[model samples]
Target: MESLLECIICKEPYNQSNRAPIILTCGHTFCKSCVHKMSQHSQYIRCPIDRKFESRDLSSLNMNYAIVQIQEYERTGILAKERCKAHEFPIVITCKTCNIDCCPKCIRKHLSHDMYDMEHPTLIQELDNSMNGFEIKIKEYLDASFSAKNRLDKEISELDHQKVKLKKEIEDAFESLMRILENKKIQSIQQLDHKIKEKEDFLKQRLNDVNEQIKYYSMHYDEFQHMKKYYKESTFIDRVVSCRNVLRELNFVQFIKPKDINDNKLRIIVDTTPLIAHSIGSVSFNEKSSSEILMEQLNFQIEELKSNKLIYNKTNPEQKLSLEIQSISNFLCMSENIPELAKMHLIECCCNEILGYSSLKLSDHLKQELSKKIDTESLFDTKIQEYIPTLRSKLKYVKGLIYSLEKIHEKEWEKGLYVLHCLIINENEYDFAELYLQIALLRICSQSFYIINQFKVIDALPLVDLIKRYTKFHFLPSTMCYKQVMSSLRFAYKFVENQMPDFFFPYFKTQYSAYLTEMSSKATENIPSEYPSELLAIFQGLDSSDLHFWKDSDLSKQFLNKVHRFKEECSPWFQALRFVQERGEELSDFELAALERSLN
Candidate 1:
């Protein structure tokens, strides 16, 4: 039996000494030495059994370990069957109860038990039939194993080939990109040269024109000197008249030199430092997304598999799917090392485990399966319902985030703002964060304004306290907080004006005064020193109605002072001063007097 497992070419029993047994691509087993000898002629060696070509060489072939184990087991079974342990005589009878064969002399001890006679002709024939059936089953298992392995080997080879092709494609793409950039660089240089040449020509023409004018003037002066020194009175007078007529005939050409076009330095559209950094970062990000890049490669691989008819499903007999046991193994074997692929495999595994099934199901069957997994006790159970209570827990998650940030700020506000800024920026990088912020803001807006309207809810903090919490957390360098928390403040303020007049009015009045102070300081700096006609154009466009809100505070006195200072320094401020002066109804008597004094 062991000799049957020997290599056909080497005629040697499979063992480690002969490099055991290994199967070629053609499903032929051979000792490693024989395969090596065949591979010496070419990498594509023919199988000893089928004369078919094997793409991989001897070293890369998979070991036939099952055959080797079978050979060892057969050799052990032969030795075990050589003699009986119960009786030393030539064993003939078999005791089925003890599972022992014995001589006829020892068989009398087992007469009362269930047993099989080893020497019975019918029993031996039946055993031979059973052995034949076992051989057929073994052959079927072997065929299936070899077929699965062949598909796996082909897939691995294709994956490697795709990797090489994709690498070349990336290299070509970068080379093409470099070529385009080089062309653009040449064009930019040529454009600069053209501009410089144009400027040079203009300067040279002005220089020649100026020199011609100087030469004409010099000749006329020389002629005058000669008349004064040597010419008679009548000749000098006639010459003077002729020269004056000539001078009148000469056209006056004003040569105004062009201002310097630009200093001797390079000017580019945008500083490339940030652009280059962004480009490098984008490349690194693309490299990290290799799985997405390989999606196109996977499509090509699928096409190749279709050509080979290696469809993974089992609706057709050509497909050999052992999904019940090898689904996970098969999935991972083909899938790239990507988290999304792993997640899909996990979802499939969980479904199979929970439902005791695989693949598609009818709607009714799916419902039945889902019913088994769901809790059906109560309609209001949290597992099956939505529960929203009063405002403390309404934005619990957002409130927690604010509280955490406050704790960090207690350590140091600067560091807290830095951490908060980092978090916000990181959140912006993902698509989901915007939705998260929007949902949180919606809940907050609804709850805060709802409480402000009710006023006597008696369950939560005031809108002012919530607004303060939001502002305390809003001290970020980024404008994101202005759009988020400041918008919330606007909503609160809108509600506060009508709902809680005393607290809201006082708070708003103070805030408005501070805002005016800051505006005055900024407007002072931005106002030009020696006001150009451009200031008159700017002042003409200012609408007095826009400043009507300033009447709500006493700070209008200081704001009027700022306008008066501008009016005294520059005449262009006259229109703006008059516009403010005419809004006499909105201004206090002191502010009106100040405006009038400025106009004077």
Candidate 2:
């Protein structure tokens, strides 16, 4: 009975004040304060008990007088009933027409109006029906609230985990930088100590020589004084010649003075400008919204596909490749403001797709896709056009390379060679540093054909010239292009060895020898300790009986070992070449085709 008088939401007993029971049109009652909170100061109110919406204003809603009377009875021993103002009697009947409660004496005021007794059985039955399943509704509401709270808690926990992970990454990054700085510091100090020791040793040796000279001069002076005091004039005259000879010899002696030591002091000059500019590192809030982060993640997946890590399989290989190209095209259309690295990766992927396909028509498909999707003007900045051209021009160069490979595949060697030569001649128009390696490889491939077919001893000169040029200007033998270049050169050497005895001997003895010397000097410190065996084999061939430039067994072996260890790592193409070479067989036709398409 006490529970029936309380509001289910606030669990407080209804009273005449803010907690006065207000009834909704749905026949559910709640305290006035809870109703106000539910209404949120609006005209409409939704019953929390039944979830039924009411359009009537909060002030217009009827009060639950039955619960109010019960609450009043609980507070006082006697039931609190309203008395008529006109006749002092408890109100019993309610007038329907006037919508008011009236006593038996005051019933004349609303006589003609319809009226009903306050204790009608029908009214009590309607009230009982209103509260059916009330507990079940309350439980549902509680369950929904708990679910929302659990979702919020999960989000907060994930955020905390991310914070900890980011903190550790920051610490690891700084720790790596600190380790590098410490190593640099130690190296610098060791170099300083070595320079100081060399200078100190030279100064000490000079001091010892100067001291000996001073002692000899003092003894000669003492001997001259003794002869003058104790010997006759005749003995002194004979000794004078010897003394003059000694004086002449002493005058001729070259003495290194303390002041003569030039200032060859070593001092370390550390440049902190780059460090000041970049600082240690930085952490800031990610400015991208949720939608933008999703876009970047999608773009990253496309990049993986472009690198050929994710395979796209279909019955027709050409169609499969075309679909992959179209995927990139679609991605480019949606995201106009892609990063520069992303754009480069896209171009590289497209090239790879075209190269992998057997059909010549896919190249045309790539061109069409690129033309439709890429925005030329927006991609290439006018200010930096010299360093990097527009994407269109880059694609054009790629198309030319593809065309040359096709011609080579068709056995149209002259046409293929012509196209490659034209590209190489106009290489400066493109990004030279980026494309130089490709052009160099193609030139070496062209020269390899001449060595095989023409059988001209002079054909090997261009190969030697090409190597000398690479060694002098662009010396990065650890790279895949460098490895391929050396491999091709070695093949050329083997082909003409029986015929041309000293074809490459002169260049290897002079220029090549000097290059090896330079590499050997820097091998211990700057250069890596592992290299491809193919690269090391080239130098081994140079140490033939005729051209024994590498004949110093002990020194040459150690130098070759260091160069071998310089870079044990190899790119995919280098590994393929090694696989073929190990079996004592030439590259397969497919391998050659792939080699011609190599961009890196």
| Candidate 1 worst ten-residue window by lDDT | 383-392
TM per model? Answer: 0.27, 0.31
RMSD of 2: 25.8
- Per-residue accuracy of model 1 over 525-599 as CA lDDT, tens digit each: 211122224323443444422222211223323333333342243332233233334642223344433433453
Error of 2 at 163 (Å): 3.8
Report the Cα lDDT for candidate 1: 0.45
Q: After superposition, which runs of candidate 1 have C-alpha atoms over 4 Å from their true positions?
A: 1-81, 103-111, 121-126, 156-168, 203-600
Candidate-wise lDDT, in order: 0.45, 0.52
lDDT of 2 at 432: 28
lDDT of 2 by residue, 1-600 (tens): 978988888999887778988888888888999988878955568776677889887777767777866766788877878756455366998887887889999798888988888888765665467565666777888898887777567657756977899889888988988899899779878987887788788778877877887886667668657655644556465666665666676677555444555565534466768757867656565766333443344356455544432344322432332332334332233223344334434444433332322122234544444434443333322222232333333333334444555554454544544454444444333332223334334355545535543455454454555444443332243344444555555454444446544765554345434533443343322222222244334433441121211112343343333323321221333455556547655554556545544522
Q: Considering only N, C-alpha and C atoms within 3 Å, which residue pairs clash in candidate 2? A: 528-566, 529-565, 529-566, 530-565, 530-566, 530-567, 530-568, 531-564, 531-567
> Over all chains combined, what TM-score does candidate 2 have?
0.31
Candidate 2 least-lDDT 10 residues: 543-552
